[model samples]
Each structure stands twice: as C-alpha cells, then as structure tokens.
Target: MAEGEEVKNKQVLFRNYIDGFPKESDMYISTGNTIRLKLPQGSNGVLVKNLVLSCDPFMLFLMRKSDDSGLFGCYTPDSPITGYGVAKILDSGNPKFQKGDLVWGMPGITACAGFYVVSTPKKGETVFVSAASGGVGQLVGQLAKYFPEGIDIYFENVGGKMLNAAILNMRNHGRFSAFDYLVHYSQFYDILLPFIREGKIVYIEDVTEGLEKTPAALVGLFSGRNIGKQMIVVSRE
Candidate 1:
C-alpha cells in the first residue's frame, strides 16, 4: 500500500456521556470510518495501527460530560474513545518516531514522569499502594522492590475495604502517596527503565480480542472480572 492511502478504520466509540458507573452499553464499535494512512501535511503527528488498547479505571472519568472543574475533557459522542495503547507506527511526521516503531503511551497527554520526585521510597519504610493489581498499581509494587526492603509496600487495587485496612496498618509518620488516575506522572520511563531492562517486573494482561469486545473489556475493570491489566487486541501485527 502506498503511504497516505486511506483505509477503513474500525473504531470503538463512546455512545454518550456517562453519569455513574459505565456499562458496556455506553460504548459501541463502528466500522464505517476511514482514515488516511499518513499524517496530515505539516503535521508532526505519527499515524499508528493500535495493536493493544488498555482498559483502565481512569477512562471512567473521561466518559463523563466535561464539567468546569475537570481537567481532562470528556469523550465526544459518536467519536472514537482514546486511551493508552501499544501501537505500531504506520507513518510519521514526528521526528522522534518513525514507521514501524512500536510504542505505548497515552496520546496527546504528556508522558508520565516525576514519580521519583514526589514519592521517593526510603529503605525499610513501609509503603502502601492502592489498586496494586491494576496497571499502575502493579508497576508501583514492582518498583517498590528497588527499595532496600522488598515487599514492605502493601499493594492492592481494590478500594473501600482495602483502603481502610491500609490506613489502619499505617505506622507512625508514615508517608502516604496518593495517586490520582487523572494525573500523569513525569519521569515514569526514567524510573522504570532499569527495572524493565532487568526484568524485575512481570506484567499480567487480560486480553479480549477484536474491537467488538472493547466495551466489555473496559466494563470488566469495574466489576473486577478482569484478572490483570485489561486490554483489547485490535490487531496482532
């Protein structure tokens, strides 16, 4: 295929603005769209073919209608819902990325960095990380291993009872680092590079194949039905 050629794009669309917990019905797959295979002229964007789409809890907040107080805008009805994903670049106008480059990160958002600055874990200090099994939580747990004391950090994804228990177990002057799903941490890659290269972290993914299963994959995150990081496989290659 020639570069810049247009092709049919199967997309997962957000049906409407959600108020409470989002259901599978809140999203739908649409096949009537097509996109250019190349980036726009003078644009610095990279065109990617999504291979895996992450279903995260933070997406629930983006499903809501944009309010004055919210920092991230809501997903538009009848448009493709966006999130972090693993993708293969098809074409690129961006200098940093090139065709066939495999990448994963949230689009249009600053790459998460600076976790080391705020929550520098001290050796032997007890740390408690909420949502430990989820995507972010899983990383936090693995990263905690870098501290002189391993497994001292209490990590779990479920809230409510878990939060209460974590708090009750807090030691004197225990520093609590609260992670907001909406906030992206700077220096994220910098902190994880060594761990990733060393294979110190193991990633568990709950993958649902096809765009049609995207809605269910996302909804499963809320019901605790997914065993690991929930994701939808849009394409294998």
Candidate 2:
C-alpha cells in the first residue's frame, strides 16, 4: 500500500435472513469490503470494473434461507449483496478473459471488487423482453437487438396491443414466451387463452410468485398454466 492510496467499495448488504415474503426493509445498502488493484498471482479469475448492475425479481427468491435446490443458498444475510451485472475487466489471471474486455455475467459474492463484475451475455436466438425498459428488461431487450438476426427478428412487448402485435408478427414455427409484469391471473387466462389454445402460440415462459400460486401464473395460458416452460421470480432482488 502507498501513502495517499485508498480502497473503498459500495455494496448492498443484507440485514438479516428472511423467511416468507420480503419487503424493501429486509435489506440495506452500505460501503465496505473493497479490494486492491492486484489479486493473488496464481488465482484464475478476472477483476472486473462494473458499469451496470441488474436488479431482477429472481434475485428476491434467492434470499430464501432454504434453497437446497441450489438457488438461494448462494446468498447470505448481512453480507455484501451479489447478483448479475455488466462489467469491464481491469485485470485477469484467467486466459479466457483479458483486461478492457466487456462481459455480462454473474460475479460470485466478492468475486470482483471496486467495479461490478458480470459474465458476457449469452449468444444466439431471438429474445422478446416484456417491460423492456425495466432494469432486467432493458438488458434482455439490448441482447435481443444485438443478436445476429435481431434486425430480422421481432422484439415484442407484452401489454395491450404490443402482445397482439408480437403474436401476429411471429415467424411460423417460432417459439413465443412472456414476462408477466402484472400479477393478474384472470386477465391472462380470460384474455389470452383463445390465442394459445388455437396454436397461435408455440410455447410460453414465465416466473411467477408461487408454487401453490402456480395456477394463477398459468390461468390465462389454458390448462391452468400449460406445462412447457414456466418459472417465476420467486425471490427478492
């Protein structure tokens, strides 16, 4: 360490373990646990300079104490919060990555300090993001547009006329999914069931608020939430 040099980090910290549903009060933000410019010589990792952090609904589910399914256990209470983000690399011992490279991926808790860390976004296929302007929605929207065929592919929003337009413009044999921003069960079932039942849609995907609440997530999809691909943001972000 040199004189006048300083190390500081700002992070979201958990205040306590949560059970059941959580509110904003369940967490807090603090400044601490920063790192130096250099890491261990033999360590195989990249030190990232974060630019953006993605706050997602799924991050909420991970806050649960018993995610033996290998989900929530990754998070701990009263610790520096970690989630996916987009970042630039500042240093690396890993051959696959180099400083100055941009990537969007998950950075393990404390994996990189100073700047936020993330993996490179995945490649391939068209992605339709609902509420595309939202925190998580924005990242997905950009990715869909950047995909090789983004220009040719349609990026649809899932509300009012947007949903109708997306469904109408979809390529034949193409798969369609959705992100449920509104937690309404009846509207989905009563409003969209006809289109789905008629094969106007190939498939659907969603992350809702429950297991017992699954019925509602699928209420509009027919058959009480058809069973191809379904999920919900079961945690707090």
Candidate 3:
C-alpha cells in the first residue's frame, strides 16, 4: 500500500461500563473505521496494525463504571477497548520506531517492581506469590526460582477473607506498591528478549483468530476456557 493510502480499520468497541462478569454481548466489533497509512505532521505517534491482543484480568477493572485508580483509565463506550498488544508499525513520526517494525507495548516487570523492589525480598527467603499460574504471578514465581542461590516459594491465590486477613496483619507504615507508575516498554522488552532467546523464558498463548471473536475470547476468560495467556490474533500480515 502507498504511504498515504487508507485501509479498513476494524475494532472491538466496549459496549459500556459493565456489571458483574462480562459476557460476549458486552462488546461490539466495528468495521466502519479506516486508518491512513501515514503519520500526521509533527505527531509523535506510531500508526500500526494490531497483531496480538493480550487478555488479562486487569482489563476487567477498566471495564467498570466507577474506576478512580487513575492507573489505566476506563475504556470509553462505543470506542475501542484497550490492553497490551503487539503490532507492526505501518507509519511513524517517532524516530525511536520505524515502519515495518513489529513492536509491542506490553508486560511483566510487575513482580520485580512489586515484590522485589517495593516489598523486601532476600536470597533464601521463602516468598508467597498469589495467582501462581497467571501471567504476572507465574513470572514472579519463576523469577524467584531463577535466583542463583535458589529461593523457596509459597504459592497460592489468596482472596476474599484471606485478603482482608492479610491486610489486617500488615505492619504499621508498611510499604504499598504500584506497577506501571512509570512505563519504560523498551526496558521491559530488553529484559525479556534476552531471556526469551536463551530459553530462560517462554510465552504461552491461548489464541483466537480475528477481531470478531474477541468478545467471546474475553468472556471465556472468566470461565477459564483458555490455557496460558489468552490473546486474540487480529492479524498475522
């Protein structure tokens, strides 16, 4: 396609701020949009086509109507839903990125920032990580294992009364932690890519093809329908 050409831009629109668990009916696939294959003058944006869309539980928080987290803001109604994703840039106004570059704005420095950085962790210290099989927790646990001297893990998913109990036991002036406070995607990828190449890290994908199927894929996440990381394959071009 020419640099100034436009192509149909398909999207998954959030129906509205949701109630309870989400259903396939909560999102709508839009096909009426078009994207120009060129960058706007003086813009710092990179125009790209989505390739892989990650589906994680945190997305549900943004789907709620009363969010005040100010971390990841709410997904607007009648507009595209948001999450981490890999895309191939078709146009660029940012010198740090260029056309045809397959870039991803995404994941898992969470455990490092939360447990290792904010919370104190030491070599040989036994650690408890919740959601040990999910994305961040799994990596956290794995990273714990990678410590050269070895670290013991007490992995479990604690919630409800257990969560309250844990909170109640917190020491006064205990440190609280937050991730994504300052995002450096390049740093994240730099850390991950080496581990990936060395086989020290691996990714699990529960992939669904096409933009239209994204809703069902998201809804199925509640029921644990997919294995590994749930993602939608929007394009492989």
Candidate 4:
C-alpha cells in the first residue's frame, strides 16, 4: 500500500489476565481492526508496518497481571499484546524518523539511534550466555565466537538443568550475562549485523504461521516444544 493509505491492522490480543503458566486460550488474533497510515497531527508517534517480531521468554511474565513491576508494561486484557518488532516506517511525526526507515524496538521503549559503545571482549575469558538460541542469546553466541578462543561462551536459554550445568562448568572469573537483566539491544545489533552479513551466524527459527497461532507458539516456549527462536509469521511480505 502507498503512504498515507488506510490498512487493516491484524493484531494478537490478550484475552485475559494469566496465572501460573499461560495457555493458548489466553490470547487470540483480532483482525477486524483498521488503522490510518498517518500519525495524528502534533503526535510524535511513528506508524510502521511490522516485518519481524521477536518471541522472548520474558513475554510470559508480561502476560500476567500480577507482575506490575516489569520494566515493560504488563499487557492489558482485551488489548493487543505488544513486543519488540523490526518494522518499516509507513509515516512519522517524529523528526528523527521518516517513512521507509527500518527499525526495531519494543512498543513502549524508544528506538536507539546513533552509535552505541560495546565492551571489547578479553582474549581468553569464557562467556556464558543463557538462552543461547533465543533472539539475544544467538547474537551473543556469535559475537563470542569471533574471539581468538572460539565457542568459549556457553549460550543457553532455559533454566533448571541447563543453567545448573553452565554454573558447574564456569571457569574462574567467567562472565555471565543474563537476558532478563540486561538492556543492550543496540550494542547487540551493532555486533550482530556484521556476522549476519558475513554469514557467520546461522539462525534456526520455529515459526507458526498466521496470527492465530501466536498463543500456541508462546505457550510452547514453556513446554520446551519450540526449537531455536520462536516466532509468528503474520504475513508473507
């Protein structure tokens, strides 16, 4: 569609407040909504066409109404569930962004523009990354591989057995970066893009087709049924 045109917005909506482990019944696809392509006058928001979405384990916590202290706001019942996505800007009222700008960031978080500094990895230090195959973990694993001592980083996504094993095998002075405890998205992309372009990183995605499968895909994370990065393909284009 052209710029400033109206389009139907397909969204995954949170059906109710979740408790314990969330089920597929907790969320549903709502495709009856339409949104204008342009941002309202005086609004600083940018309108975007989402291209890719990230499925992180932390999303389960946001689904729970009890967890109000999360850095990302809790999902409201009957509202569209929001998360990080790579998108193409369709229209913008913000001076920093314009139509066709490709970007990625969480719904409530501001996109990081300009350059971000990342710490240089020491030559021989071992790095342990939990959720190594997940969105963030995969990038961390690839970055660690670039060091002279290759694959020294232990990248894991799940806890329990995997985390215990990682702790048991950690070398003295080894560094551990937890996905839930860090905010290094910009730095991650900085290092990740090069590897991606060089074909150094191989990504495995477990995708469920259609927005209707979103809840099932999410619930599968807890059951260990998903392989690699779990995602929902809402559209082919």
Please report the candidate that would top lDDT against the real structure.
3
Relative to the unseen true structure, what is the Cα RMSD of model 2? Answer: 17.4
Quality of model 4 by C-alpha lDDT: 0.66
What TM-score do all the candidates reach, one by one?
0.77, 0.43, 0.74, 0.72
Model with the higher lDDT, candidate 2 or 4: 4
Error of 3 at 118 (Å): 3.1
- The candidates, ranked best first by lDDT, are 3, 1, 4, 2
Runs with alpha carbons beyond 4 Å of true place in candidate 4: 2-5, 41-43, 105-130, 133-156, 168-175, 181-188
Candidate 1 similarity to native, TM-score: 0.77
lDDT of 4 by residue, 31-66 (tens): 799988878889998887877776777788888776
Q: After superposition, how far is residue 17 of candidate 4 from its true place, in Å?
A: 2.4
How accurate locally, in lDDT, is each candidate?
A: 0.69, 0.47, 0.69, 0.66
| Cα lDDT of model 2 by residue, 127-175, tens digit | 4544433333334434434543432233333344445544554555555
For model 1, where is the 10-residue window of minimal lDDT?
A: 107-116
TM-score of predicted structure 2: 0.43
Q: What value of lDDT does candidate 2 attain over all alpha carbons?
A: 0.47
Per-residue lDDT over 1-237 for candidate 1, one digit per residue giving the tens place of the 0 to 100 score: 688788888888989998888898998888898898878889888788889888877788788876742454778898888878899999888889989999976521221221344455677566555654544444433442444343334444456665555555655455544444345434455557677689986767788999898888788888777876688888898
Provide the clashing-pair count of each candidate structure. Answer: 12, 19, 0, 4
